[model samples]
Structures are given as C-alpha cells and as structure tokens.
Target: MTAPPKTPHPLLFAPAASQGSVPDTEIGRLFHEMDWSATPLGPVEVWPQSLRIAVSIALNSRFPMFVWWGSELVNIYNDAYIPVLGKRHPQAFGGRAREIWNEIWPVLGPQVDEVMQHGRATWNERVLLVMERNDFTEETYFTWSYSPVYDDQGGIGGLFCACSEETPRVRVERERDALLQRAQGTVTTLQGWFDNAPGFVAVLRGPDFVFEMVNRAYYQLVGHRPIEGRPAFEALPEVRSQGFIEILERVYREGEPFIGRGLRLILQKEPGGPLSEAFVDLVYQPVFDVHGRVSGIFAQGHDVTEQVRAVEALKEGDRRKDEFLATLAHELRNPLAPIRQSAKLVKTPGLTAAQHHWAIDVIDRQATHMALLLDDLLDVARISRGRLELRMEPVALSSVVASAVETAQPLIEAKRHRLSVTLPAEPVVLTADPLRLAQVLSNLLSNAAKYMDDGGAIEVQAQARPGAVAIRVRDNGIGVAQESLQTLFQMFSQVSSALQRAEGGLGIGLALSKGLVEMHGGSIEAHSDGLGRGAEFVVHLPWMQTESLEGGQPEAPQGQAALRRKVLIADDNHDASTTLAALLELDGHEVHTASTGNEALALAEQLRPDIAILDIGMPGRNGYQVASEIRRADWGRGMTLIALTGWGQAEDRRQAVAAGFDEHWTKPVDTDTLQALFATPGRAGSSQAGPAR
Candidate 1:
C-alpha cells in the first residue's frame, strides 16, 4: 500500500516544498515527514498554513476572533484574541465544535451551517450568545459578519466570521432612556401645579417688559389681553405716560428690584371713558439664568384699595377725638374759674360767727368739686399712657376712710343721706399708697351721692384677714345695670344712658380708682343685684409689716404775720391777680397787682418791690421776658421773682428757672404753701426754684 507515494492535499504543503525545495526550519521538516493521507480525519495535519496566518493577522490587528470548520472550532490566533474566549485554552483548538463551545453551540453552530449550505455571506448580524469557555463561566452578546468559503467548483466549505462584544453599550443605552422618561414626567407635573397656584405670577424681561408667562390670577388683575413677546409699554401704552416706563428703565440699568406698597395706578379700558383704578402692594424680583446673569424679572402683588380706604377712615376718627378733648377742656374750665375765685373771695374777713361758718362751708364744698374735676383730667392722661406710678406705703385703712367721709360730708348732707362708718377695733393696715387709698374712697362716696336722687344711707366698713385687708363701701342708691357692670370702669364711658341727668362728669373716677388699686398690688370689684337695688364696691389689699409712726409736725398755720414789704403780682387774668393780692394783703404784706407783663416790669423798676409774682401768659411780653428784664434792672435785682401760672409741666418749670424766677407755683396755687413761703425767712425761698433749662 505504501508503494505509491501518497498524494498530499495542496493546503498541507508549502508552495516551495511542493516544487521539490527543502525547508530550513525544524517545524517545516516535521511537517514534511508527516503522512497526511494516512492521518485520522480530525488530526492537526488538516489545518492549512494559510488559515493559521489569517487568524494571527486578525488577532494582531485589534479585532478578536474564532473559527469553526467541518465539526472543529479553534482559537488559532495571537495573544490578543486568547482572553476574549474566556476559559477556553490553546488545547481546545482541535476539539469538537459541541465540546469546546457547548454554551453557544445550540445557536451558533446552526447559523454557521446555514451560511455554508446556502453558500452565501451574512454581514453585520447581531446575536446574544451566552457562551461558556470553561466549566466555570459564561459570556453574552455579539455582533459579527459571516462569510462562507467556497471551493473552486463553488461548493460550500466553511464559515469565515469576525465578532465584537456589545453588552456594555446596550445596557448603557437602556438606562439613559429610563432617566429621560422620568425627567420629562417630573417637568409636566411641576407645570400643572404652578398653573393652579393661588397667587398671581408673571415672568418679565427687565422692568417694563411684557409678561412672558402668566398664571390665571395675573390675567384677572390686568384685565387686558397680554401680548407675549412684547415689552410692557408696547402692550399697555398708557404705562409710558404714567411714569412706569421711567421706573422700569432705572431698575434695568441699576439691576435692582423694586417693592412698592399702596401704589395707586390708573388703567385705560377704551377711549373717552373713565379709567379703571387699582391700589396695589407690588414686589419685583430680578430673575437670573443658569449662568447667574440677570435675565429678567418676576412680579407679584395684591390689590389693597379697600384696606387703604379703611385706614384713612380710622385716621379721620382719631382727629375728631383729639378735637373733642380740646373743646371740652376750654368750655369746662371757663365756668370753673369764676366759681373757684368767688368761693375763695367769700372766705374773707369780718362776719358774724354763723355767716363765717356758712361762708367757709360753701368755699370748702365748691373747692372739693373743682378738685375732683381736675383729678379726673389728670387720671385720663396718665392711664392712657400707662405712666401712672403708685407711691406704696403701709397705710392705715381706718384713717383713709375717716378722711374720705369728712371730705364728702357736705355732699352727703346736701343730699340728706345718712352715713355710717365701721372699722376693725384693731388697726387694719395694708401695703398701698396712702393718698391713692384716700382717693379711691372719696371717688366711691362721690359716685354714690351723684347717683342717688333722694336721701339714702352710705356704710363703709374695713376688716382684716390673715394675709390681706378688705374695705367695702356700700350705698343705698340707684345701682348699675347688669349689662353695664362689665364696662363701668372704662374711661369716658358712662353707664346711665340719660345724657341730661344730674351726673355731670367725664366718667373717669371709677376707671382711675381701678388703675391706682392694681398699681398698689391690690384689686377692686363692684357688685349689684340689679338697677336700684343698691351697689357695693370692695377693695382688697395685701397686709405688710407696719413701720413706726412719727406724726409729722402740724403744718405751720397759714396767714402768719411777716414783715410787710411791697409785692407786685402780675397776671393776665384780672380775677387771679386781684385774689392773690387780697390774700397776700391779709397776710400783712403790701401788695400791688398788674395784669400785663410791661406794667409789672415798669412797676418793679419804680416801686423796687421786695417780691414780684409774675404770670406766664401776660400779653405784650410774657412773664419770662418780664422776669429777665426785671432781674437785669439795677433797682429790681434785690426783688424776688416768683412764677405764678397754670403751666405746671416739667418743661414749664425748667423754663421758669431759665427766666430767673426765684420760685414757680402752679395755678389754683395752694394758699397755705404761698403763705408759708412769705413767712419763711432768708434765701430758703430760692430752694423751691425749678430745674434749669
């Protein structure tokens, strides 16, 4: 059988070797020695040299590959192609196609056979192949081109393929699609919510720019149809003439936002008709682009016409209240002045004992009424500002009650009411302002007298408790209505509806008493069954340790004789000057009266009076000017200058000192204090001068 040399396949020998030339390398010699015709069908001798060279070039050219031929598949390539086959090794080169590529064989082997059977080329084909290279691992996904090799007779032979793994690129594309879908959905939801928002919204470009986007509320406010891509002045031409254009231009140049409150704007609807009006509180905010450059502006606002009108009405009401107070003070004080002066004048000299007592009683009664009115005025001013201060001390409840009853005796007697007073056998002491306690008692007694039409009894009682003292004033008179009880202590608010009744007052007594009591760390309450059943007011104050009592020396008797001296009294009011001069004269001092500042100045220079009393409100020149001139004069330097006026504010006292007055006294001057002033000797009088300006 070996007699005839076996014919080798043309693919197995080198071209030069087939021409009878010898190869130089050992591999070449080994190739020549092998008998290809006698070898097994699946042996390595069947692999062509051309096939090996082609695979090496493909793997070295930056592309990965593998080959299958007639039931055998091999990774006959360079180093770069080896790892792509995963666990498959060089030993797998001659293995059966099923054994080497078991994971991908089911799909890949059939496709390769299909190309070879048809003798056609498959190009740019994509496939998902989960292939196991070794027993341990799998790889998926491929894109490849397959071409069938043809014999010279055009018979199907093998498949030539090239592949690229594309699993990472496919996954990345799918995830990107999902994120884009979510972002689009979120944007749609945000737009829906913003459109239905309650507040007006608009996007503008610069100050006078038209709204690029607007919500429903913005349309309702502007009324006019909006022109989207135009400036504000172009759409609403009236704005140019209304000064809005200038405001916009300035804001754009300055890059500042503008916020305005209660701005009134007029809008035009049509020709030859009244304009539409609006009061707005508006805010402008500068808008920035992603690069942080100012690109536009946003505007929002509320219509406040109704609110502005309401505030104007409130201010008008406040003005009327102030006017009423001024008028009341003027009208009330005019009549009070004459009555007060007449009472004082009636107390003068030489009368029968009965007449003297009658005159004194009349004077006391009128003075008390005037004092009560003045007190009410002061209380209202102080309470309104929360400036009332209480001078708290250990007070004797019984003594305060006694003094109040004595003060109100005339009123009680005039009404013919019986008064009863009850006090603890032991002293009832309370921590309170003594003067304020007396004031509270006097107010209650006065209120009771004013309310009662006929004679009625008033009973006052004081009792001590473990930690507090209680004082009660009970009156048998017309009582407060159930509805009015809650508001009885409100200032300027009267309980009785009858305006023409005998109770003529500013309705501040009870209110002031309540404030004073609370300030002393005490409380007061009013109780009544119903109208006309009678009323009771109870005051409770905390008890504190009592301090030792030192009875103050009895105030020196007023009207005491002093060395007679020439005294000039200057006052604008004739009655005040005359009454003051009369009182000084009775105190054994020679007195002269001047109703004008110039007259007083001339008199002081002429008479060289020992003392000068100047009124601040005199005509020609005020008392301050008169006093300055008198002090500067040679003859008037020795004379004492006293300011006598109704101006009692701290600033007024300061001005008096600046004007060179030796002393300052408020009007309805305390006669006793004045008398004591004249009686005291030396420069002690100068000590009473007020603060310098």
Candidate 2:
C-alpha cells in the first residue's frame, strides 16, 4: 500500500518573506497585497499548495493564462491575459469567474464544470464568448483549454486555463473570402459583356498566337471554323502570306496596339477552299502580365468588305465623270469652229452661188450634228427621270427595218462599208413603239459604222427564236475587248479614249440605245473574241403572233393642204420671233410678232388671229398669263393657242394645257410639225379647228 502524504508545518509552507516576493509579476504583487480574509479561499498565506502552485504558474506565464481557485472560483490571470479582461483587470484578479464573465456564463459554465467536477481536461477552439469587461458587452473568440488543479491531498481545487483571442484573425479571414467571391463575379460579368458585343472579339495567347477566347462574331468573321485553342496560322493557312500574323506578332513584341482601316486580307472562308478577298477595320491590343510584359494580344474588328468595295466603286465613278466632262467640252467645241467659219464665208461679197450653197450646206450639217448631240443628252435625262413616254403601235418588222436603214444610210455610205442584210423567211410583226424600234436599229447601225475602219464588212442578221426575234449587228473592224463588254453600256463609258476620240463620239450612243431597248421590254448584249478580232451586238425583242399585215400598221398622216392663215408669234427673243414670222409669211400666211406678254395680248385682241404662238418666258406677264387672258376674251376664244418654249419637261406640257393652250411644242420646233399645225381647219379659211395636241 502507498503511504499517505503528510502536511508540512505552517511556518515551512508559508512564505518566509512577503507573499508578493513569491511572484515577480504585477498580478502576483496585487494578489499578495489583497485582503483575502473575507473570501471563501481565506488568506493567501493559508491557501493550499495546489492553489499557490497554480497561481504562481498563471502569474508568470507569457501566454494568456487564467486561474479559478476554490469554491467561489475567484479569477487570477497573467499580464498577457489582461487585454481579454479589458477594464476588469485589477478587480478581476480577486473577483469570482462567474461574475467577471457573466455575459458568457451559458457557454463557459459547462466547460468549466467538466474540468472541475470530473477532473477532466476540456479543449475548445475558436469558441465564441460575449463578456462585459468594459462598459459594453463585447463579442470575442478564443482558442483555449481548461485543466483541473489539485491540492496537497490529491483532491481537485479549481480550473487552470490557457487561451488566445482569435477575434481579429477570424474577421480578416471572412473579409478576404468575401473579396474573392466579388472578384469572381466581376470576372464573369466581364466575360458576358465580351460574348454579347457587336464587333468580333478574340484573345490569342503565347508567341504562336494561339486562339484562347473568342466571341460569337469572331466565329462568323472566320466562317465559323473550330479555331479556339488552335494557332491562328494553323487554323487559317491561307492567311499566312496575308501578313496578319506578322502584324499580331509585332504588336505583341512591341507592347503597343495597332489599328487598321479597310485592311485587305485573302481568306479561304472554308477548309481547303478557294481564297476570297476580305477587308476589315481591326485593332490588335497587347495584354500585359503582372510583371508588365506582353503575354498575348486582344483582337477585335469588323468585316468591312462591302463598305470598302462601295467606296472604291464611288471613286471610280467620280473619276469617270471627270473624264466625261472633259470629253463633252472637246466634242461641243469641234462643231462650233466649222459653223463660225461657214457663216463668215457665206457673208463674203464676191462669193459665187456654188460657194455660198456649199457654205450653207456646211452650216446646216454642223448645226444638225449639234442638235443630234443635244437630243441624245435630253433623251438620256428623260429616261433616267422616268419622264419619257413611248407611243405603242402595231407595226410590221419589214417597215421598221426599212425606216432604220433609211436613217442610218448616210453614215453607212459615208464609211463606204459593204453591209449585208438577212431576215427570216417569215415576216416578223411586233407590237412596239415603231419610231423607237427604228431608232434602236439606227443607233446600232451607226455604232457599227463608227467603230469600223473605212470599207469594213458589216452584217445585219435577224432570226425568229422561240419567244423572241434576235437581231445581230456584226462588224469586222476594231472589236470590243472581252473585259469591257460588261461595262460597255454604262453611261459615258468608253472602251478606249483614243478610239472613241478619233471616232468623234460623246460615248453615250450605246448607253442611250440600251435604255431605249430595255424600255421596249427587250435586252441587248455585245460579244467579241477580243480587241481587233471583230465583234457583234445582239438585240432580242419579244415576238408577237400576227396573221397578215392588213391592220398591223399605223395610219399615215394626210398630206398638208395649201392653206393660208393669220399667225401671231410672241417671244422675248427678237431674232426668234422675227425668224419664225419670216418662215410663216413665206408660206403665204400673214404673220405678226410680239416680244412681250402685253404686246401678245394686244395683238391677239386687235387681230383676232387664227393661230397664236406664245413663248413661256416673257416680260410683264408670262405666256401662261397671256393664254389665260386670251381664253377669257370673246373673239379670242375661237383662236388656236400654241406654246413654243424651251421648257420641255412633262410638267411644262401639263402646265401649258392648264393655261388653255391647244398645243405644246419644245424648241426648236420641227418645220414639218409646224406646217402640219398650220394645215388644220379653223385657221382663217377652214371651217372648224382640230383637236388639241
């Protein structure tokens, strides 16, 4: 059996010096100086050996340590544990544990009781505790362990605890975790923005420019290839020689961004497919790592191929327009020189009759040439503006061919070219604008004549196709180039400047002919082996099924009868009014002239003229006002009103009729048309007037 331990003598157990001498810390000094007679644990000098040993250990500890001794569970802590006590330090040194930490008694009571009653150790990590150490209750966390303390007889005395406050570290960890979550959310939002962006976006990593991240538009730009994670050049081998790879590498190496507009690239569009041209407005921006070094490039751009092509086309059109203007000036001046010289020659005093006649012929021919040029220009304008009206009529194809040959005979014979005409055995009939059909054929003949060398052979062949009549004009001289065939009929387009200039043309005949042919629901095309290899222009017109040519013909106008009438001519131009009056007077009609609207009205009222010709632009009052006033008068109501003016637009003709005019004629009016007007009834000697034009 073990021997029972005996208690030492009081003098031997008690401190020989002061109680404060046993502990070197502040808590030790306070404990020794305190009056413990009033506590259950009694005086410090009479305390049990276990309680003294534990108190000494607690007071000397550097780490936070606390001792709860005897039945009252009085508090005693080290210097490091003072912060946990807050303002309860000196008082809590001798205070009961329950009272000092009453705010947290619910949590602390079980752990303390387990260690005290069972003599078992209790361990708690990061345990929450709420204590009223200061004026306010504070939230705190501590990692601590409680171990039982024993007295001299081996019975449990109280609990000794070792602790560390973990409040600051726990709060720091929580804040760090929250920031990481927010950072991840921001990254996801940024990725979403990139995916939905309108322009193409891509990310390339490393020196090989490997595609890392790409958006929806980026896939479309590259024809939806599975390119992500692949090197750019390896995915699009066609772009290897296109210099895009070099550009991206340069941006990465230089750490600078590159922006390009309308940059050209040749791409395959599909795997192992033929290459096609592409244009883009792009930017390559270098991405940097934390060390301030370029790690990759961000590629973003638009496929601007259509816009670039449109801009290029516009530039070409502008250049062509400039060239056309220059050509127009040159052509217009060419005729003026001869006309001026001929007029001077005709006025020479000693000129013979033959010489005067020759001079007159030269002037007439040049004037007609100028008129034709102006007519072509006006026709183009009217067609472009959708104001030209075609007179539809049923006509035999033979008649149209005869009319066209008659009109083009002068040019054809002038070139001294041998022409062959071939037509299908069956007569071709068409419901077409007769004059316009003849005009289309005449233009083709003239074009053929102009492009060929003198005396070149030409052929005009017509055959009946399934649904149409095909007329082809073939020439053996200066054939059109294959490349120029596509743009041959474009307005003001010339195959070659030297050829067109030498041939004396304004470069609009083919374009005008094309417009006229298309207006008749037909198509025209040109074909040639190559330049100098001969060429052919083919015209296709819709066929009409007809039996005999009995009623498929327009009635010819009756011959003008020899009738004299009183004529009134009003014009602001003296030369125009005088010349017109002279022509009508020579036709045996008594003619009067007026230079203003007021004069015209006075003359009409005084003479009650059979026919009144008025100009739209006049002083005091315009022709519309004069015509309106004339129709309101008594005797003037029976007179015929004719508007002869320079304004020839469809709107001008409508306005002329609205102003009570019987006819609207654009100047310079054809002499034959004016003669036809004079032959109408109710002009001085006739019974009744004809219908208004």
Candidate 3:
C-alpha cells in the first residue's frame, strides 16, 4: 500500500538548519541552540522523520505541547508550553522526559509508558502534581494528553503530549471558597451573640414589618411561635393593638429609635391562652442597609414587672407608717393618764393609808406597763438589726413556767381573768435563754389577758413531747380574725381595735416573742377558728437532758441560800431604790438607799459596803462615773460594784466593766437572781450580762 515513509536522518529534538533553516517558532529557536548530542536523541541532523515531524508539530502549535523523541524519551516543547513548564523551560528542551519531569515522574512516567507501549492516547484533567518551581515545591494542577509518535515504518518512536496548567483557576476557586466559609462563620458568631444577649432582641424587615429574626428571650416572650418570614401582625396579633406595630413602623419609616419604659401590656403566654398584665422597657431601633437606607426595625426590651410592683408596695408601706404613728401616740397617752390621776389622788387631804396604797398601786401598775411596752419595742429593734444576744443554759421547764407565771400574774389579776394552769408531771429541761424563754411565755399570757374581757377564762398548759416541750396559751376572749392570724406576729402589723392598741399594745409583742423563741431553737405559732372563737398561742422548745452538763458548773442556784452582806442601792427612782434596799434588808443584809450617784458614793465611803448597786442613768453622776470614783477610793477597794441599767445591750455591758463594775444587771432583775448575786460573783466579762456569776 505504501513504499514505507521517508526515513529521516536523525530523531533529534533540535531541528537542523536545512529543515526550513530551523522553525521560526519559539520552541524551534530554543531547540536549535540546544545541544541535542547531550540527549539520547543525539544531534538535529540524525533525528528520524517520526521524531522530527512530532517536534515540528510541537514547535509550531499555538496550544501547549511537549515531544519526547527516541528510546530515552528526550524532551522538546512548543512556546505555549514554556509557561506550563515554569522554570523547567530551556534546560528541559533536550533532556529526557522522565529526567526533566522527575519531580512528577512517578505519575507522569506511567501515563507516557501507557501511550508508548499500547500505541494509544491518554488524557488526564486537572491532575495534581507537586513540582519544584522557583526554588520551592509547588502544588500544581494540569490538564494533559499523551499520544505515541510513530516512525517512518509505523513503529512507535516516542511520546507527544499537549497540556494546560489548571493551577491558577484551581487556586482562585479555593480562595473564593475560603472567603465564603469565613463570611458564614462571622455571621453565625454574630447571630449567636445576639441570641444570648441579656435582654430580648428581635428584627423585623420591610414596610409590613415581617419577622426576620428573634432572640431566645424575645421568642419566649412572644409564645415561642414560628414567626420567621411572617408579618408581626400575623405572628403576634395581640401586640399589634398594644402599639408595637405602630412603633416598629415609625422606626422603619423615620429611621429613628423609639423607647417606651414601664409600659403596661396585657399579653397571653401562649396562643389562645388567657391574657395577663405585664410591664416592659422597650426600644425599637432602625437597622440600616449598606446604602445607609432604613431596612428594618430592631426591637429590644426587658421585663420590669417586679420592679413596678415593688414601687407600689413601697407606697403601701408608707401609708402603713403614717397609720402606725397615729396609733403609737394614742397608746403612749393611755398609761400617762392613769399615772397623773394617781399622783393627784395621793395629794388629796386626809387621804387614808389604804387610799394612798391604792394610788400607789395605780401609779406602779401604769409605770410597769409602760416599761414592758418599751422593752418590747427595744427587743424588736435589736432583732431587726441582728444585735440581740442569747444567754443559753440548761434549766428546768417547771422553773421557766413558774417565772413566766409570776411575770404575768399582775396583768392577769388586773384583768380579773380566770386563769388555769397545767404542767408536765416529769421535769422537762432545755438548753435555752431561761430569761428570754420566760419573757416569751409571759408575753403570750399577758397578751391573752389584755385582749380578753374581764373574768374571761385563760389557760396555760405545758406538754412534753418526744423531743420538745409545747407551752399553750389559750383565751376565750376576743379571738384573732381569720385573716389577722396569718400576720398576727408580723412587726408593726395592725389588726387590733383602738381600745386594744391603747391598752399598751405596740403590735410587736408576739413578733418579739417569736424572735426570742427562735433564737433559743424554739418555734411559736398562733391559731384560731375565727374572731371570738378564742385564739391559741403555742410555743415549742427543744427538750434537752440535764445530765449532759458534762461536769460544767450548775446553770443556776438550786435552792435559796440567803447571804447577809452590807449593800448600798442607788437609783434616781425612789421606789426602785427603796424597794430593792428593803428586799436586801429582808434577807438579813444591812442595806442603804441612795437617790443619786453622789448620795450612793457618800454612803459607800462611810459604810464601806460589801456591795454597791448603782443606777446607770442617775441625775448628778451616772452609775459608771460613781463606780469609777468608788474604785479609785482606798476604802471602796474591797466593795463589789454592780450596775443597774435599763439598757442591757452588749455595749452597755462593756461600758460597765470599763467603769470598774463587777456585775451588770438589766432593770427588773429576778428576786432569786439578785439574792444569788450576793452569794457568788456576778457575770463579770464585758461580753456577758446574765446571772452566770
């Protein structure tokens, strides 16, 4: 069919000058200057026709092309392929294909061999290759095709290839993808921060104010409905009537922010649910687009319902304060009136001793009543300020009851109430403030008598339980109203009539009793069926064993051990000074009374008394001054100074010690404790003010 193609002189990658005097193309010019003998393809004059024709096709092609000639696969390429080869240009022209592309030969060599051996064409698109270019290993991508070049006799001689570097396109696409990912992350972070903000926030777009986004707080407030992409009126219809839509429209249209504080709204918690009142501090801020045009309204708010209600509650408390001031003035004048009348009666001519005693009783009773009321008020002050201290010790419950009964007896007799008493057969002991416990029970008993009509029955019962003792004070008098029972012990609470309030009712005795009982690990509760059905006040105190004293000193004296000692009593109140001196003398002690500190100091130096009891608030000089003066005297060195004060605060006790007093006692000290003070050293430390001594 064919007389075999013309056999070219040599298969040189570099064409000879005779071959159109070397190709005019860029690769041809480069090939002619290159040394072909240095390659396996030898010289330009010796290249075979198949190799020469392949090189010619590569050199003249507008597309990128490469040619490998001879058995060693020597390289030759076109001008368009120079940029694809990168820095491997002129030097690669005469080198073997495998040697020139050694960085990628592992993959390229196999493709070339497939085309040369099978006489087939192979194509690879965007094949990834790591190659050295510009002194660095570059991540490169290329599209390539390889075909076998046949010689004059139709036998394979070398490989020819066409390629395009896809690196630039691939790099651009990768950069765009990275940019998009960064944009998405930024948006997600901003959205997250908005959703977790402390206050509620939402976004509504368009003239219709379509819901675009809502934070968790805003979503919860609006009933957690599917609101996105919906109009505000459609999603939250009720809020439309509440002016929310009107404000949103104003913000969007005017590009201005709207703020509404303490705005009241009636809103439903869920769809089709009952509406409830709420208050909010709302803000509607306009969101702007890149063009600086208003695009949407950003709604933000906070719930202030509790803050609003607290303001209302404060107003109510102010109203109560005014009422309490009015009640207090009326109550204080009640005792003053009786005392004044009794004083005038004592001045009457030819007054019988019995009549004088009656007047004295009236004055004494009224003064004592006023003193108890002041004590209750002071106790409340200490309780509220957390300055109250408890002197706790183990004492017999029977003894506590007897002391409480003694304190309440005057009030019960004054009211002419029929009193009944019941006590446990076994001794119920407790670790508590015995004085405070007595005060608590006495307050409850006195309160019952004060509230009850004359001759009304009152009961005092003590029951010992497994772990506690309960003292019950019940009266068949004016029972507490059902509503009043709940707040009966609340401080400054008003429930009683004007008459009851005038009868020395500060409305804090029960509250003070509760506070004192609780300090000693006890509880008090009041219960009643209704007003006039009779109210019952019960106090429960933890029961403890007396044997657990653990070798400690006895809590109190067991029996009366009267000691005769020379004693001086000082008080501005004549009745208090005389009454105490008389009591001391009755116990077989030489006693003297002083109406002031100067009188007491004179008596103390003359008598050189074993004990000097001084009143803290006397006229000429206070008890502390007298005690200091007495302690400085040589004759007063051995005498014990006991301070009597109306205030038994911790600071008061400290001042007493600094003034050289050996003991400090609050007013109206128990008769038994006073006698014991003569038998033993009193509680001496500044931090203490009890009968421990």
TM-score of each: 0.50, 0.70, 0.74
Comparison by lDDT, 1 against 3, better one: 3
Count steric clashes of candidate 2.
Answer: 0
Whole-model lDDT values for every prediction: 0.68, 0.83, 0.79
lDDT of 1 by residue, 1-693 (tens): 559888755433435345232333332344355443443223433545545334334433556655555534433333444665666655454345567676777776667767867766665444667765655654466788777655334555455667777767666766787777877788777666656666567778854576687777666656646556778778667656877666666566666888888888786655455678877787777777788777787777777877887887577446544544654574467556756665665766765787666766656556655765776677667666675555666556776787788777878999898888889887666666777788889889988877777689898888876777788899978887888788677665466531235564666678888888877778899999888888999988777545433573244555556656678998889888898899888878889988888998888888888778889998998999998897677666666788887765556777888888888776777777666667777533233333421
What is candidate 1's CA lDDT for residue 151?
37
Output the lDDT of residue 589, model 2.
89
Off by over 4 Å in 1: 1-371, 386-395, 428-436, 465-468, 497-500, 551-565, 595-610, 619-621, 624-641, 654-663, 670-673, 679-693
Q: Which regions in candidate 2 have their CA more than 4 angstroms from the true location?
A: 1-198, 215-224, 271-273, 497-501, 546-562, 680-693
Better of 1 and 3 by TM-score: 3
- Give per-residue lDDT, candidate 3, residue 321: 62
Candidate 2 lDDT by residue in tens digits, 347-372: 88999999999998998788787877
